[model samples]
Target chain A: MTGSPRPARLMDGTALARRLTDETTAAATALHRRTGTTPCLATVLVGEDPASVTYVRMKRNRCAQAGIRSRHLALPAATSTARLVDAIGELSADPDVHGILLQHPVGPHLDERAAFEAIAPAKDVDGVTTHSFAAMGFGLPGFVSCTPGGIMRLLDEYRVELSGKHAVVVGRSAILGKPAGLLLLGRDATVTYCHSRTRDLPSLLREADVLVAAVGKPDFIRGEHLKPGAVVIDAGYNPGNTGDVHFASARERAGLITPVPGGVGPMTIAVLLAQTVRAATRQLGLD
Target chain B: MTGSPRPARLMDGTALARRLTDETTAAATALHRRTGTTPCLATVLVGEDPASVTYVRMKRNRCAQAGIRSRHLALPAATSTARLVDAIGELSADPDVHGILLQHPVGPHLDERAAFEAIAPAKDVDGVTTHSFAAMGFGLPGFVSCTPGGIMRLLDEYRVELSGKHAVVVGRSAILGKPAGLLLLGRDATVTYCHSRTRDLPSLLREADVLVAAVGKPDFIRGEHLKPGAVVIDAGYNPGNTGDVHFASARERAGLITPVPGGVGPMTIAVLLAQTVRAATRQLGLD
Candidate 1:
């Protein structure tokens, strides 16, 4: 297979996610016994987008398995921004709800940020609010964006050394790429952000010791562009069940890589559940 | 002179600052005439570190010159974080106070972030709060750190094209380097942050089309490290009237450069005055 040099080891995100789910289950049980209040996550969805609906359902089912309760709010797609804000505000004020997750892409007309900001900082389990973002940037105590947080966990589990390494993040979306890069920077890896406006992508990619493919385009990063033995993280998901990086050729050059299907997807929900328990424990004064 | 290339065009921050000050003065006068209330800035300083005191005085003097009122609060070095927080909270609540500037390097014992959070985001004209930082990162409406804001203004006056250009930030201190890099990123520049842990400094610097030298150490960057014809912004302030970049050598290679003393220094105060008037106008519903 094209002079494969041991075909770079795949990071096992699915296995790690299972381990995390078990741990979260125990923590949720302990929290429930101590406080007599099941950790509740308020999940809000403003539209009937199939992807968002399925994703929210997946999270709620996981919550049930972990002994966490779900308070689901399904608003009409035509809801006003003000009404959506009010709905989230009610969830924020409810003491029983330990965490909040507002499914994103709440329609183009709605003010997503205004709605996200309505989630109380303490209950922002999805880490979508400005408060959580600032806390992440400042290295303060707060919940992190689930996907980026999971990517970091995967790197840690694989024992990849981040310090002094050149990490090139190939996207700058608020939740995924920007936070991922900042989190890497916090670990002392020299960080660079290359976007659509980047002049020379191949040149920049070759300098990266760790490359995070976060641009939502299938096969955006190829083996030719990769630095030898680079640690590649594919954080992008497309409709055809592929990642931003071309898997087959990338494995030839990469020392460590994440597969499209099992790499970043499961870890995200696992992190969300774990953070939900932590949020509940903190709110219940048991942390 | 070893092949003296035409010296880099010096960015005249002093002249730009003067023009900005004239604009700020006129704005302040208009706000006062319409609302019958002068724009007021509250300057809070902890510990009488001679340099801190001098810097506060400089800002206060500039505020007065711009037709802005100053309320100075100099806390004793021994004051606890609680006391500092309480003092800042009072000013945040004061209706007459249009803006707040808390000098950085507030003693080692106190929680600086906690104290910063006490100031309401509305009056955070100095932009040290988490809200302001998030706003800056999200490319939303908010105040910005004075020095970084001034650096942006200087770049604008010179008609520097930032889109798709590589911007290298030499440091990552909370107030200066971090904000400056984020600001550049918002302007669509491909940004890189290189700090003490960076492995190859010269390699990264050579890629920069817009280089921001913000490391506090003098002579940290040299001419050989710069990309020939790069826009060099030396935002460092050293004790002996020098900046982080080696001026004589850098001028030979740089296409445009800011001098240590007259560049980046005056423009900071100008932005502060301008933001104060803006805060007042917005608060008074005149915006």
Candidate 2:
């Protein structure tokens, strides 16, 4: 291992998100001017998860900035699956709502999948539906989940070639890890997904030319596990704004590393807004 | 390694499939008696791929024996995407055709994804549609792809516990490799997908508790790569009925191994018939 300190090139999501939001705002304005109706996103949150509430608020604020209308539905934590499904169904049936974003980890007892499924595929701008996941996995055209979509966009923006690259995704959660791996595969990268119980995670991580750490463990991936000149994307959003990677050690070894605070975090809302405008455009047959 | 020769336990897919077909036959009979409509599967094929033809024939024979109706759609090799889409759309819209199976590798030029997408999710018996793929990946209730479904059935038939196992799937093809890994992930297995450009493929194979060799290369996986006592499933069927895993060497090292000709092949047809009945039952609301 080189003891030399290599300056890691940062992937600035905040700047890229600003650019994306500008494009989305223009698209939303165009749609509104042509159709006399603004693109609308319905944000549904169950219970009072501080994180969920904060995420929805951020999304709504971004929506307003992008010239998209925001419709908020805050349900009680103890809401039943049937009632939640009914509400989502109603929103799906509403013509004004072009997109729907159901905040993740709805509650302890609610069936999150059933609730997400209720959102019509056309209006599933958050890309949490099974339809979206399948489309992503199969390399079919569909809205991608915000975080993973953000990661891919960053890779594309940096001109990091994905074809035949060994991408080791250190997480396997449905929305994050699995979808991330599938998206990498869609770009022709040979993706290997590692999870909590995966034996020899370090060994697999070392083989990656592109390593995506989404396992939510702060500083779980150290410098030694990184392949020399590997592009590292830390998608973990832990408390205190910590990342999954040990950045100090990783930056010394990595060719590229995304910082915790300004990296992948900002891109989520940007993609959400971008997809909202897309959904509106497609619904109105503008595209 | 133990020098003693252990007699290979046969993975009797034919017998297991027969048993499953018998059970399905009874279910179909019951449904027919109650609803007066036999479950039907529409098999669509483009061009005359000899292997695919044989596969479809086998499925139809099995369906007939199980008292299920078969609807066949055969298009010429030069069939346009629009015509093929139209044919599939017709089948998808047919109320009598409860399930749809579009035999794969339609043509090099044809957009297979578009063709597969034409089948409605409700009648996607073979589970090739994006909706079924997402459903499987998310651990939701949906039809599974026949080959992967058959592989799971074979594992269950032999009492192979998947949870917490290190499963190395050596392929990433849309239907087989990709879905196989997702199915394993759904079962809580730590799944790693290796493909054509995957570096150190053999080394990854050496670490697997369960190894699924789905890459089409004949005898690609050698015995040296086999982890001792690994449950090996060779889903590859090459010319002359060869498998991707070198069975002679793998058999020496593996605790259990599925023979290429008999292991996963029969299970595919069995699963198709079973899922056809399932799709029929679900669509008819008879279950």
Candidate 3:
């Protein structure tokens, strides 16, 4: 029989997210009690895409459970970029809406960056704007892009030593990969930003002490490409609940790994709700 | 001489900057003729730091030679953040000022970021603002920090292949290293950001196809740590007219290298002057 390697330690993002949400709930209650104003998260969905609809509804339900008010606007798929921007702008201008979440992939035709920019920086709970990006890049105090922000929380919860470690980010998407790399770099990790244009993926992957699998292709990275004992954070969630990393193989090679369904998904919601409360606290001058 | 290594091909930033300035001169002249408006650069210096004074004077002289107007504002060393911000804001609002340049290291007492943020995005020729950094990170249209912008031009002039190349940026200063890395990433180069906390410097150095030395330490990176035939662009300008790269040793190992005095320094001023013309063109509706 071949020698068996120790199975990777699983990062329990679900448990951490639940604890985080509980803390957020307490904060939300205290905030409401002090101001007598509910922290409202207004989610704007530009299209009727089934996936986006489910995501928005799930977030709204989570918000309700956390004592935060939820407001939903579902627009038709054919909504113009200008109209979508206008709708988000209106929500941004509304004093009652403490935070705004615009479901991404608004449509292929829509200029998503332009629409995201329309969300006021103060109300950008999802943290998808250039302002937030700038804040993350500058290492300044401001909102972070939600998915990556959750990734950081998971890393912290797991006690992964980031400083002086080599973190290879395997995507450069605006909301996820880019911000994740910046946040990691800000924490003093030597960060390599690899994307579709990167040459020799295996070479970089093999050297990554912490590999952020965020390319969005299901099971794109295999164990063969990974360094043994690498901390693997898979940010991919597909229709079948699969991840960007080959989970079974990755578990064999990685020292730590995050499961697809239970890992990053819940953390995203937790960070969003937390940021909403923080935004409310700031906007209401209760900070 | 049997084992003599081939000397590196020098990257002549001086010639490139001169050629760029000539082009800028023509554009500035054309703009003045068409709109009867001279491209004006307002140089705001807080405290008479000697090096800053010399740098500002050099820029003002370049503006004069290139047919662009320059306005100098010298604030006292005791200037508060609010006063400095207000002064920059006034120049930003002034239609006569086509661009604004805030001489950096205003003093130890000031918040440089807050002061840099005061420069309006439209007239930010120096590109030290968060807006410019975001633009670079997003690959969006906006001016870049002068030194990094110059670095790109030199890279382009030398026809260095950025796509898929591994670029190692050896600093993370807000104005220089961070923007430089972002620009390199936007060009499709796999970028690794190494800072003071980076461990095993030689390992990362050996993999760098293009090395950007911007750590502001004289001879911080040496030849022995370098990959043979790497293109080295040193951005450090020390008091003795030296650079971050140990030149003699770097030339022995590098395929191409920038000479200290002529390398990144002149290119920076050239980019600044060129951006001044652009800001003028856009503001005057000559674009």
The Cα local distance difference test for each model comes to 0.92, 0.88, 0.93
Docking class of 3: high
Candidates 1 and 3 compared: the better one by TM-score is 1
For B100-121, candidate 2 gives per-residue lDDT tens digits of 9999889988988889989998
Say which candidate scores most in TM-score: 1
How would you encode candidate 3's per-residue C-alpha lDDT over A1-287 as one tens digit per residue? 11127878999889999999999999999998898988999999987888888899999999999999999988999999999989999999999999999998878999998999899999998989888999999888889999999999999998999999999999998899999999999999999999999999899999999999899899999887888889999999777898999998888888999998889889999999999999999999977
Provide the TM-score for each candidate, comma-separated. Answer: 0.98, 0.92, 0.98
Task: Flag clash pairs in model 2.
Answer: none
Off by over 4 Å in 2: A2-4, A30-37, B1-10, B33-37, B76-80, B93-95, B108-110
Which scores better on TM-score, 2 or 3?
3
**lDDT tens digits, residues A82-170, model 2?**
99999999999998999999998888799888999999999888788888998888777889988999999999989999887889998
| TM-score, prediction 1 | 0.98
- lDDT per residue as tens, model 1, B1-287: 33237879999999999999999999999888888999999999999999899999999999999999999999999999999999999999999898999898899999999999998999998888889888888898999988999999999999999999999999987778888888999999999999999998999998999999999999889988888899999999999888999998999989999998999999999999999999999999988
How would you class the docking of model 2? medium
Q: In candidate 1, which residue pairs clash? A: none
lDDT of 1: 0.92
Docking class of 1: high
